[model samples]
Target: MSSCAKADASSSPALEKAALLGREFSLAWLRAAGVSDPEVAVLFDQVILIPAAQHASARFADPSLPRKIVRTIPWSRARDHHLVLAEAAKQQRLAAEVVAEHFEAAHRFDLARAQWMKAGETSCHAGDYKKALRLISRALAIWPWDEAADDRARVLREMARCATNARLTDEARKAWEELADHARDTGKHDLRADALHQLAILSADPVRAGELLAEASKLATRELGPEEAFRHGLAHVDLLVNRVRVAAAKLAFVAVEEAALKSKNPALQSEMLGWKALIAAMAGEAGDATRFVEEGMQIAITHQLPEQVAFAYKRRANIADYAGQYSLEKHSHNVAIRYCRESQTGEEIVCMGCLSYACFRTGDWKEALDTAREVLGQPDLHPGLRAIAGGVRGMIAAFRGEKASAFRHLDEAIRLQRAEGMVGMEFLTLWALAYWHDCQGEGAKACAIYDEIRTLWRESDDLHDSIPGLLFAGAHYADHGRAVQLADCIDIIGEILRKNDLPEARATLLALGAEQARLEGDHEACDKALREAAALQIKAGLPLEQLWIESRHPRAEDHKGVIALATKLGTKPLLARLKGEDCGDSASGLTPRQCEVLSFLATGLTSKEIGDRMGLSTRTVEMHVSRIFERLNCRTRPEAVALAQARGWIKLP
Candidate 1:
């Protein structure tokens, strides 16, 4: 409250007449700016004064000088008019009172409004949003006699626009709330619903946001129709769908879809289908996801909205993210970016988040850093987004060997995620932090973090992401002491893997089982598990896993050929412990399968024929032969056969 604005009570009475003259001039000026007498008369009606016919005609012909006002006229609208004139006087560097009188008598109100609004717009364009906001407020408060007294919602909405440009979210939210109240009081359901929709988006609390959106939907349906109802509820449905509240999202989606179908709105229908695909993709229902995504895109092509096209592309990106195809994900995000608007901050931030994750996975560190920093740079970002950005920075920091920076970023992510009740992200951040701790050699700390999430992992929720995280934790848990924990890990994860037919998890489980058996001194069991896991990994055709499994078993790395191959593959960290190791078969207790493979190899059977005979893939057969060579400390099949015969480990026919 500026002192100048607060001291309105003690102004001299003569200032009042200046205001009266200003209002009469404003209405006359409005007529000259394309407003007709009928429009003015109908809107103003009886209570408010209209310019007298003869005087209005006279003023139109030849405007009187502002010196005509010498008597006081007492009215708030009049005082407000004078205030506007005083500012206008200062614009021309004239005496305030003299210009105020001239403004009331001869100056054009239309041009004054245009000039003030243009000044505010220029300030906004220059990024001086605070000054723009203040200037815009000053413009809006400049009262004229022909005011739209019943249309305060529009006024409040304009004020909210100013606050938004200034990045004053709290002010904008309050303005929208007030606007909603005003519209409701005036029985304007459409305006009220729109205001509520804006308020829902501005709210930080998810529960509050959902409530506000729901209210808007209900109000629209009750006062308008199903079409408007869905329009108001669309954002809420998207929010729930993306956040993984499956049941709630499905309910809202169903309602919106039904409304879209009933109203025959292709654009809304297309958007609804896009959301369906996104939800299905998040749930890992790839067939359903793909079908819905295609249907949505075809419909979007027929629609006028660029946003719907962007929605369809974003769903495709989500599917790619789930499939671990980072390149495809990036491509989809780029396409989506083209259709997004400058005002679409939330949508832009989400695409950036996904792009950052894809870049991180594909080892494009520079882009990852750029995208994460871009999200963090957004004005008035949500806490969950903050946590997401911090977590990404942590991973990049760790990769760059900045240990302290990594811990700082990850710790903040974990803390904010937990505080915001972002349960899924909290779990993942904790999982990532544990891996970072292990990488920094804080093994016990890593194990403790695993202890925190092990039970949650067992719940079979979000398994696509949680399974890998838990697998990492399970491996670290084994390092702390696995004899007791191995059975539990195997039992829980094995059942889930089998149910889902997840071969990768199954292979990794087998590898962990091998380590567990070795820890328990069951060398035979250990060798059997390793052999099966290696065969599976080879069938899966993942070179990284093959090298990783070899790293775990030093005997498997004994072959100079494999070491050279691993070196070529840039697997130095996994192969680091392989150097200066014993090349004896002391730990690998060969089983009957290995013996059978040895006999097959001795008979000069190729990998394909060996696989045909043994009911395995050629790659699996190759893996078995490689294991045989490793266990026998040989570099070739013939060498392995000769070593086995010399040791009398196998009998030849």
Candidate 2:
């Protein structure tokens, strides 16, 4: 200002006049330097016009000088000065306004970025990817060129992966597209590779997905260093592993097995090995399944991957349960649960399901009930697990004699199975419902459900192949006097037994044969059958079955044999029943009508002859014999006669 003042003073009058009127020059200069309109207006009022007017007033000693100068200047020049001052004010305002405006814009940008970051984190945490993707889009719009945008883009790509993990295929596709666009725009090679990787996952066309992942792997290998690129290679292997597993689940086992053998990633190789084990188990290759699971276990143990260890355990449990090794099944389930808990994984539901079945098979109903309760509480359980839990509960209720409650649970299980399209499990639920009906003595209803199950089993080709639902159906029919059906079921059971060399099947067949012989009234055949059945029962260590068989044959000759066998078997209850010594209450001393039926049976009279002699329907006579058998702890007329003679209720001549 000192030099400028001296210059103004020493300048020619014409130049000084020009300087005094230099408002246009100042305005143009300030405008060019980015001053805003409002700032220019303020400068006009406080600096330019006011200072000039005050200087003119003080120097001329005339208040009129200000007015004279204002008026004497050409109208065009005056207008130009006013316009220039207004423009300078505008430029000043624009420059100052832009600071806060840009700051607010930047703040909005930061907020959007933070929102996207939170969404991405939440998506990764909760596996809800659609919301994360939408939030990221909003962020990109707000701050497309932000410094942290690349990091956020990377997160968006990861969110896409989460979408694929959650099975949100469509949402994953959208996220992949966005990531691809970002990669293309920003020239981030790693981002490009990641986007392509996700695109591989999102692509419904498996061929296209494979191609994309292959390209991505090659690109990553070329661009990224070894440490950074290893993850991409692993991801590519994981995709192929998942694809193969999906195909295997759809029953393309051979192809999937071949693909799994070709996998390179250690974790994926272990997982595919487990899948191969499951397929082998299903295909009835127990030895192969065991070998595959062992290999997978070794790999998982070496890696210290608890989740993989849990998976291996589960596969082994399934194989054991399928082979009816209840103890081994229980051990495997325990290992699975331990590993799942250690890894903080949610596979406890599967382990609990296995434990429930194993406990049920081993006759530990209380343990089964407790494990089923725990399975029901897990929120992350699959629908199939819900159905299985309900079925286990129904089994517990049935065991406790709560028929109504059991039926309710069975119905709920059926409903869930149908809703989930779990056809295999639906058959199991139906079987339970039929068994419940059989327990309630609703034989007709049970028969109808059993027929449906038989049809389903045959259609699914699952009978005696893997699951044995049909075998139970056969047993149910055999117990209820469907002999022809029982014989057919016997053949099926025999084939399965012969093929598998199962001792349990031999016992079931012997029991069924004994029941058939008893129904035909061939005492010799019945005696032989009962002796053989009891021997097999004893060999199997089935004290209960031995008791049941001994109770079935109670004629004087048969009774002697039964009591001898029961004594040998240490079955006191069966021994008491065979001796006919007032076992428990004795049905309040059989009614007079029962005595009349017993008299005819003692005389070798048929129910028709008894009906003719007593002037009653044959059905009525048969009913009397049934009641007499129930009252006398006997299963046949001869047994009833023997018991009556021992009780002095009838003279057997």
Candidate 3:
């Protein structure tokens, strides 16, 4: 109906038949469709065909001409041509997807289904998951499930796999659930266990996910070999570890380690050792963590297993982080990222996310921001890693005064991390958001967030989470004069520090103690506590935390080093807060009274009115105004007010 001038009524009948083959059809296909050699030669002479870019012999010169010509023919005639083309394609061994299309056009769906399944499987192997999903869905559409149970089961498995790879979580879950039911009915325990394992991976509800994993592990142990069962056991342990159930993770790891040893797979043993190291590190078992790391590193290096090697290094970094050895943490994470890169296991982004946090802790804000951005830029990054990168980006943005970007990233990080069961990352992001609010003087909002964190900590009763939680929340409460709330957090922190004995934890407790002293107006106690906290923070190598403790010193001149370091780190938020503390000596050289007058000038108040408010004579107010303008090198009151505000010398409100 739609005309390409090249395809008119006068076109050869053989060409019209060839058009049923597709836009592109071979000379041999035309002959096999019963077109004579001379007819093909005549069609070529008429310039109705052209050389195809594909290996096919020849194609219609105007591709649309084929569809037009085919439309002109009756369905019966087209069906015959399609059947012939399908046969020719089968003999020529064309792509299964291509052959399936011809067979479907010929209404031979039984034949089409097999080719479609094959095509889908091929696409899946090629990592074209969306295409594979489409093709498998097509195969399922035409074939009745009970008619061919084996084919149906295979199609469902591939459907779930492709859907998972495409990140269609709901669809993948449904398919896996269906497959699990089918496997159970068929008494295929191994298949059922594998389906359950996949379901656990997609489930967002931690309790339901853990249940599924536990069942999967039992089934794998009962029906599969030791190695397969160990794999499932390790997955369960990993879920527990990620959820901050450290004691439960440790208990689960005992069986997993036994299974790994029974399997006698060196790589699995090494991987198990790595998880042991991480769990031990988190549980404050430093000696056990060190022993596991040594054994894991030796086995991984001996086997030249890059992924296992990376796993060992990442656990070592975890140990360093727990001990407050930030420089070693950064170096170990770098090595882990390097090994991840070499292994090509798609875990480099996750390691980079860890590096970003380490860099942030060490006051390398620029590198942290860059690494976070790079990790976030990956389109297919795992949800947990995405949460990590997003948190880092949000925290850095909050520090640099990008309020909107900070809120957006931080909110998404919390949502995704919680959904992915990354409790540790979720807590960190919440703390960052609360810290951002604190820096903005939104004390109520900051405390509200901290309250939510405390509620979660109470519900989980996870010491691994509580140490950082209580410490950070206490810092916020202290800053905002929430003395009762600060006392509560301090008590919990003191209890945790007694057992953990981590230097960073001790420093945070000391800092909170200083704040408590300041609130009570005990200047000597505050100064002494601050000095101890600052020294501990320095030994722990946490410059940012150390800067905060130093900046809290009542004598601003004594803590000039804090301002200098904050400036060098380009931590704009800290610099802003520190400058506010030392506002008496502004860069503009305006005296405290003169700075006060500059704020009043910005409000368009006359000298007499400002004098009335300050209990000074109009002449004295004018003199302060003149001094402000002279020091600011401004000729007009408006100019002086604007410049002073720009330099953060005063806030009008």
* Per-residue lDDT over 480-595 for candidate 3, one digit per residue giving the tens place of the 0 to 100 score: 45789888878767766765678878887887887788678787997898899889888888787787676566555675778889888766666755666423441234566776
A best-first ranking of the candidates according to their TM-score comes to 3, 1, 2
Best-performing candidate as measured by lDDT: 3
Clashes of 3: 0
Q: Candidate 3: misplaced stretches above 4 Å?
A: 1-108, 118-128, 301-307, 337-349, 377-379, 461-469, 479-481, 581-653
Q: Native-vs-model 2 lDDT?
A: 0.60
lDDT of 2 by residue, 1-653 (tens): 33233333432222223233333333443444344556545433333223334322212222233444454556555444444433343454533222222222335445435545555566556656565555545545555554776675676666566666666778678767777777878787787887888787556565576678666766666677543355565555444433322232434333334444444556666776776786565445678889999999999999887899899999898777555466788899998999999998877777897688677655556687899988888876776687878887875564344667788888988777555444556666776677566544455677788788766544443322222344446545544446687676566666656544444456556656655664565657756766776676566444434555555543534556556655654333335445654433221245667777787889999999999999999999988888766654448877677645533345566
Worst 10 residues of 3 by lDDT: 581-590
Q: What is the lDDT of residue 461 in candidate 1?
A: 41
Model 2 misplaced stretches (Cα beyond 4 Å): 1-251, 421-428, 463-472, 475-481, 522-653
Put down candidate 1 lDDT per residue, 1-653, tens digits, no spaces: 32222223223232233223443444544443344566455323421233446564212111232223333333454545555554544554543334434343434444444445556666667788777666555545554524553444555676688788677998788778777877877788998899988887777676787788888877876787768977876777766643446567677776677777877888878877887887676565668888998899998887656778887888888876654455788889878877675336348787777678667655565787899999999987877788878887886665344567888998998777655545556666776677666554455676677767766554324434454456556555554454566566676667656434445557778877876776666768877776677666566544445544555553543545546645654333333433422222221235557767877777888989988999989988888788766544457877676544422334455
Clashes within 3 Å, all models in order: 1, 17, 0
Best by TM-score: 3
Off by over 4 Å in 1: 1-126, 132-151, 218-228, 301-313, 323-356, 359-393, 396-429, 443-461, 482-501, 507-653
